[model samples]
Target chain A: MASTVSEVAEVTRPEQVALRSSLWHEAFLRLKKKRLAMVGLVFLLVMAVVCFIGPFFSPYASGKINTAMINKPPSFSHWLGTDSLGRDILTRLMQAGRISLTVGIASMVLSVSIGALLGALAGFYRGWVDQVIMRVADVLMTIPGLPLLFIMGAVLSEWKIPTDYRIYIVMVMLSLIGWPGLARMVRSQMLTLRESEFMQAAEVLGLRDRRKLFFHLLPNLTPLLIVVATLNVGGAILSESVLSYFGLGVVPPTPTWGNMMDAANTLIDFQKRPWLWVPPGIAIFATVISINLLGDGLRDALDPKQKR
Target chain B: MNALVEIQNLSTYFKSEQGVVKAVDALELRVHEGETVCIVGESGCGKSAAAMSLMRLIPEAVGSIVSGEIWFAGRDLRKVSKEEMRKLRGNELAMIFQEPMSSLNPVLTIGEQIMEPIMEHQGLSKKAAQARAIELIELVGIPRAKEIAKSYPYELSGGMLQRIMIAIAISCNPRLLIADEPTTALDVTIQAQILDLLRKIKDEAQTAILFITHDLGVVAEMADHVVVMYAGKVVEVSPVVELFEEPKHPYTQGLLRSKPVLNQRRAKLYSIPGQVPNPTTLGESCYFHDRCDQCLDICRVKQPPLRDGGDGRKVACWLYEEESVRGQ
Candidate 1:
């Protein structure tokens, strides 16, 4: 017997168009209407645009600190107030946004690329390859990420690496260590997608494994990878901040959110002048929260099971 | 038509933790140009694996072609570089899948999916490829071709998605189409329509089809030749009519008998006595010996060779010794 849709049309295509027009499109459009997700999208867009443009209009070059304006409070001249070392807080904040957002973006790119590649190979091949890759991932998972980052930073510092390049060193460290969890998630996703009929079809069509992984299998994984990449940016930013708090991030003169908090700890400076902590702290909170919200929204939207 | 695809002693084995899993063992079949050959078996019978091995799609590290020659259009597939194989996918050969819902890229629109192979294989201009995509959509019987071409995978129903997949598969006008249970997920009436669509494509495009399925009904509906697989081995190969009317292999007989007849008043429907042996945990004996109604001591002691019966028919059974001798 024919299906309900099939009864309405003899060929497959018309029935699909009718069914889609009546159901799937409406449901998806309704979900895209979520207020919080849209707000999150706007927030992310603003932050991205502002940061992208921040370096261009920055008042002072990133390295220059004004000695005369040391530790000045918030005013019309210095919107976020001067830091302890007299850099324009606004300039420093913008410059720091460049570093923060770059670290977040770069580390995510590195991690996701490495993670997705390894994960696809592991999950698609399975057996010995899967066992070896997963076991290594398991070992990485057991090691606490923060402590590992600290140790890596200390080792790199002891080696007297270039001070200006310290932040990049930290980013690489975070990516190398951070990839295991994302890799595991990606591996499972690849595992699921590998068994999908599309993948089999690709194989039977004489498509190579690499092409199938890059095209058929990987495209299906976009939603999961997107969510993970967003959250990963948040994670990478936090790692940078934490590393900086311990004096391992972009050397002392360079203003970072973590360095701002680190500077605040001296002589109850933060309590006396509440403005110092608030600006960088708010920046950190705003960026992280918006990314998290975006991730959450995407997770909901891409999920095939969840109804609007 | 000359043979467009030929296989000789193709065996694909996986090195698993438990043991060596032979997913496709000594499978030999041929599909002439514009022919439709059905590789029919229940799940885990390695019909899909045989298809995979032909393309060398199984990962070399985990699974290897222990011994085989897969010649497609007179080229040895095993000797070709991976780059050449990828180029072959949408150019000389393409495939349709069982579940259309999962097969089409969810993020891509129908036009983009159809356009991909045209652009990749044929290097057609954007406008030209898009025009071809629309034509393909119409060719597959999709209505409102322009409008439907703009929709994403999730926007289409199962049957519609299958049609879209058909459009994409036939985009490059490949010579051979390996449709692995192409209509298994579709409704019965949709299955008929899809089978018809496939037959029409085969005739019009002159594309050979390596159809994989377990359904005898689907085989009768579409196949010109039939290969019955049991536990990774091809037990019988014959013209579809002969295979259905006088099947030589016991397993084929069992499979044909297992199909539920129309309005039959029955205490029980016929079924193969045991579940297919898991490939990872297979034994040395005849793959079907444990469940075969005609099992003898020799059947349990050793696997049977796929010996020729007569008139392009082959059977792997001890009972076919006289026919096997005549062929030798």
Candidate 2:
């Protein structure tokens, strides 16, 4: 009874605050109402905190290989157990998570910025500017994404790029593959907004083309960009994992989730060393799924036409 | 009074798949300072095309101003640079659209929307602009001006949105306000309120208004003078009282009669016969000939030139032509 009263108090407090805030608060309130989305958000926050900070507290934080304890199963000393080199898989999973999440987030931001800018330019200035940008996006979109990433990854390995440098390059490569789809979405939205009568009202106000595009046009595309950006994070993480799995991305020395999984790929290791591969696999799956659920919730929450 | 906006031989054309559509063909219009000149017409009669042309807002894909001289306060608008035009617009000349529902940005606060033109045209500081926005919103007769300013467009009623649109339009205190059917989307009481608001603003600001609408009743209430258009051509121009009391051209007569009269219990309302000529195929003959009741033999051959009627009125019909028997 006391907890229920507290819960009601908690919900009403935000509503009171929302009355003083802007429409963003209203959207946030709606977002809070979506159960799956809230759970997804919570899970993502937990995962992020754990991945970014948990590795420091582990006993084997430096990951000095103790080959004597190789292929040990779940036990009190090591929560998940030991890897092929007898490094703590639990500690490595946390470390791998940091790399994977950084790649996902940085690439998503880079691609969303490039995509939205190009899309706005195309939609606002529809003659030659539109044709040039859209055609470039179209050309990029025609090539399949996974194969393109693989080919780029293969080039990095062929050039024998340093493993440390490869993570940054892999982020850039994933963003390169990611932009065309988002650019198309933003452009089509820009085209629709360009036709809206409010835009005509803007023209009449003598607003400069820059003001019209940024203040008027781009602001309207916020919800769509947010949802697309959220979804893109998942795709980026998955792509990075695949790239790393094939021994091309942040390679063996880097301790990425993909490389950890890759280390346990031998026949003997695959049959016996579940701790090596399963933890990283579960982390990748859980993170991507949480992001997708959050994206779905944001789409609903941000849609102004949707009913309460 | 000097002409605030004088449009001479303004022709706007669109290239359709079939042929070139002369949306506003060689149109002539003049609005004196502090006067309300309503352009009355049926649909597809080029009223809006003329308005769009005067604003220089014709989208490259939609259409273009083929030729014309739009003189505003002694400057020929067509000859002005794009930058100068941008400066002139919303500062010296402002416009409000018909659809209040869609005219405002749904995402922005009404306060911010009103402040936009104030900042853009006047270069006022953000704080000053916001204060002026509240004042303007109050001037438009909205209560709780501060609260209203903070509210987004979707939160307002249609009448309120139109009022907010008016506030934004008048923010820069423009010399000319181009109102394209500003009240057509509102209910009767709201329409009257909006019209009153416009009249109040015009009187206060001494601003010239180029009003466009199909409603004769609205023309009667708001227009100081009326320009009747048909098939992309101005058929008549007259003082509003004279327009209501004695319509000159056949098109104007049809428009007045088509409006339903109160207390006249008629089963069927009067309607103009025949359709407006397809813009793609308009010929040399008077475009109204097929639909006009007083069509002369000459109307079937050469088009009638606009003739000066007494009392500063103009009519473009063969009935007023002194050489009435030219074709015969």
Cα-based lDDT at residue B257, candidate 1: 87
Local accuracy of candidate 2 as per-residue lDDT tens digits, B293-317: 9998878888988777878899999
Q: Candidate 1 — which residues are off by over 4 angstroms?
A: A1-4, A9-181, A208-210, A235-265, A268-271, A285-294, B6-28, B40-46, B57-71, B76-87, B125-127, B227-328
Q: Residue by residue across A203-293, what tens digits does model 1's lDDT show?
A: 5444456656787777767778888998999999988988887887776777787777776676678678777777888888888988888
TM-score of chain B of each: 0.96, 0.97
Q: After superposition, which runs of candidate 2 have C-alpha atoms over 4 Å from their true positions?
A: A1-22, A67-70, A158-160, A305-308, B323-328
Of the candidates shown, which would achieve the greatest TM-score relative to the real structure?
Answer: 2
* Candidate 2 global TM-score: 0.92
Quote model 1's TM-score.
0.74
Task: Report the lDDT of model 2 for residue A207.
Answer: 89
Please give the CA lDDT of all the candidate structures.
0.82, 0.88
- The number of the candidate with the highest DockQ is 2
Each candidate's clash count: 0, 0
